[model samples]
Target: MSDLLRRVATPCIGVCSTGIGDDVCRGCKRFCHEVIHWNSYSQEQKRIIDERLDQFLVQVMQDKLHIINAELLAWQLGVQRVRYPAQKDPYIWLFQLLRAGAGQITEPRKYGFVVDSVWRDSSLMELREAIDREFYLLSQAHYERYIGRYMQKEG
Candidate 1:
């Protein structure tokens, strides 16, 4: 079969609870509308959305973790049996790294990462909390902007 004929797998982390008023998916960080309409989107459109999510993840994660050698990191992930999206986004890998390493991450450089001092100094739970807070704020802002346009149009 042609590669183009194969559909790209959805990045659904399986925590899809978009039934509420959440404008974003908590697991994958995809916009709720994007999640709902994913199966209907053309490959090019899906790619575009994936790229946007990648950009957002990188923007948020770069402040907390720095990737050194992406190839080495991928190798390490394989060795550790850590599951993450296979996309080229380093930030997603970093998320997996953080989850896998947690308290065990004493020398992040060895894992091809350099976590922020704030994260490095704190417990993994603390880091996770901070990341969640930041991501939630970002999602809320995006939701307001997206919904505001529709609200404005109706008024």
Candidate 2:
């Protein structure tokens, strides 16, 4: 589908932590206001939000993983029926695979990636948590630097 015709999918994985009043959600790594207002956002707004998230995941994975085979990664995501946005950066697809079931994967090579040498020894489950933690923190930092600053100035 064309970008204009296609809707940007919500990042929610059904593990929302925003109800407890978190500034950023743990599941999708979106700011709390973003989650609450997602359905109301215009297509362009949604796309911007999605892009920010994709960039965050890409940043977190940059040092920790390497996609050596883009074709294989695409094929594996399809073969495994991983739910990811098509036509996105391959790193986003890699993040989706990790989010869906990192532990289920034993040899990332089969999925077309190799964990960095430093993280190769870590269990995929552990790696998944670390990635998630970093992503959330990064989102939180951005929110504080931008939104929070705006709010503080306005208040």
Off by over 4 Å in 1: 1-7, 85-87, 100-103
Per-residue alpha-carbon lDDT of candidate 1 for residues 34-53, written as tens digits (9 for 90 to 100):
88999999988887777766
Best by lDDT: 2
The alpha-carbon deviation from the true structure for residue 139 of candidate 2, after best TM-score superposition, in angstroms, is: 0.2
lDDT of model 1 at position 123: 71
